[model samples]
Target: MGNVILRYINLMVVTLLILSFFSFSLAYLFPGHPIENLTGIRLENISQIENTEFNYSSGESLLVQYWHYMGSLFDGNWGVSFNSGLPLYDEITNVLPASIELSAYALFISIFVGIPLGFLAAMKHHKLTDYSLLSISVLGYSIPVFWLALLVILIFSLQLGWFPLSGRISLYYEIPDITGFIMLDIFLSDIDNKEAAINNVIRHSILPTFSIALVTTTLIIRITRRSVIETMNTEFIHAAYARGLSGRQVLVQHGIRNALMPIFPLLAMQFTTLLTNAMIVETIFSWPGIGNWLIQAIYHQDYPAIRAGMLAVSALVVIFTMSIDLTIRLMDPKRRRLKRAAI
Candidate 1:
């Protein structure tokens, strides 16, 4: 176990280095300096930019520049944004919570809603419920995220007025930045309007959450349906049924647990996918998250911001990937040992 942990840690370190290298390369790989591109004036003098540090200069070689960049990562001197003049690391930190909060909610919805629908579809194989769920999953997966965002905004926000159109929380309640997560902050703070704050936060979150959740839920449905259907045909599932377990009991006790073994990787991949889709969803809804921040950085051609955002996002992807693998392995010790033996 210790050896396995060390191996994964080493792998994660190498992955982070590689990702950071590509992310940091944006400074040279991009056509022009962000300031130059934004101002339509060539930066003959790097000193003109106020209160900022450049990672490298034209005088330095690529390897030397990367060395400085890596040093800055450990030294906590990631430089400031050309567009905002804020520390790039701090800026990434601020936006990450919103992205995490949104992704968390979306994932919750995907699993809670999708898994059951999938199981029902499998259980009802040739029935109307099965066909209906399949169609819904198809439509959900097929639609573009931006279009889904707009459509939901139109219906729920504009037409029905059930949820807010954009943002993480209502302006009516100013939750403090205790934990960076708005809803969680609201709960922690003695704001005096905890119920209202909670309610408003949830209401504001519904539309954007739904927009992203629908796509992931559809994927979960298909995957779950396939996994469960196959498990249903297996000898273990048949034995459970023959042991006089009720239909629901057999599916719930024997089927769902076994079916989930194949779904761990999908969960990890879907989490990353949710982050990618968030770039689109955040823009359409004007949500103040990393995706929206990254879009703004792009428009201004803020290389520092771009580099920081990409590295931050990439690190998150790698972390979640590793974490999920650890979690699934812990859930099934035999499978973990088998993999270790094979390796």
Candidate 2:
């Protein structure tokens, strides 16, 4: 296991280096540099354009500049935002919790709702209930996130006036930032109406969370249903039934556990997917998250911020996925046996 982990870490390192280089190159090659965005001036004459003030390392070549950029990254400096003149690292950290909170909530909703629905569908396989859920899942997965988000906002915020239109929380309640998550912050705050504050946060979060989780939940349902059905058809499940075990007992004890083993790694991958999709959801909901921040950085052609954002997100995905893979191996006895045999 140790050797396997080491090998995976080595692979992650190589992959990150490749990802960083390409991402850095793409940011650098963007049509308008940060200088243009900051000064509202374009250098039409390439030959005459020297890095006099913008700090492109005027005396050094492109390779040297990139080398210095990589060095700075290692030194925990992501440079400054072209528009705000603040450190890119600070900006990323400041906005990261919003994205994390949003993604985590969406995943929680997906798992809790999806797994049981999937189990029921599998239990009632080839029946009307199964077909109905399958259809719903398919439709949910097919609907575009941005469109769904907008539609929900229209119904809930505009037409119905049930929820707020945009923003994380109402400006009326100034919840102190305890954990960077508004809900948690509200919970932690010394407010007169603690329950009301938390409820407000939940109400504000519902549309965006639901919209983002719709597709993810459907996908989970589909995967889980298929896995459970496959497990049910296996000989071990039949053997458990032969032992005079109740159907529910067999399913709860043996079937669901076996079925869910394959789903963990997939869940890990979904974390990154949710994070990427948050870019659109956050924009639509006007939620303050790293994804929205990155969009603004791109619009302003903040190359340093762009590069840093991409690398940070990529690193997070890679590390998280690898950790899940390791967890999956540890959780499944069959995987442990295989690893032992391979070793």
TM-score of each: 0.90, 0.89
Could you tell me which 10 consecutive residues in candidate 2 have the lowest summed lDDT? 32-41
Off by over 4 Å in 2: 32-64, 337-343
- For 109-215, candidate 2 gives per-residue lDDT tens digits of 99999989998899999999999999999999999999999999999999999999999888888887777878777767888988888788889889999998999
Q: List clashing residue pairs in candidate 1.
A: none
Measured by lDDT, the strongest candidate is 2
lDDT of 1: 0.82
Each model's total of backbone clashes: 0, 0
Tens digits of per-residue lDDT, candidate 1, 14-61, equal 998899888777666778664443233455665755423342433467
| Lowest-sum lDDT 10-residue window in model 1 | 50-59
Cα deviation at 47, candidate 2, in Å, is 15
lDDT values, one for every candidate: 0.82, 0.83
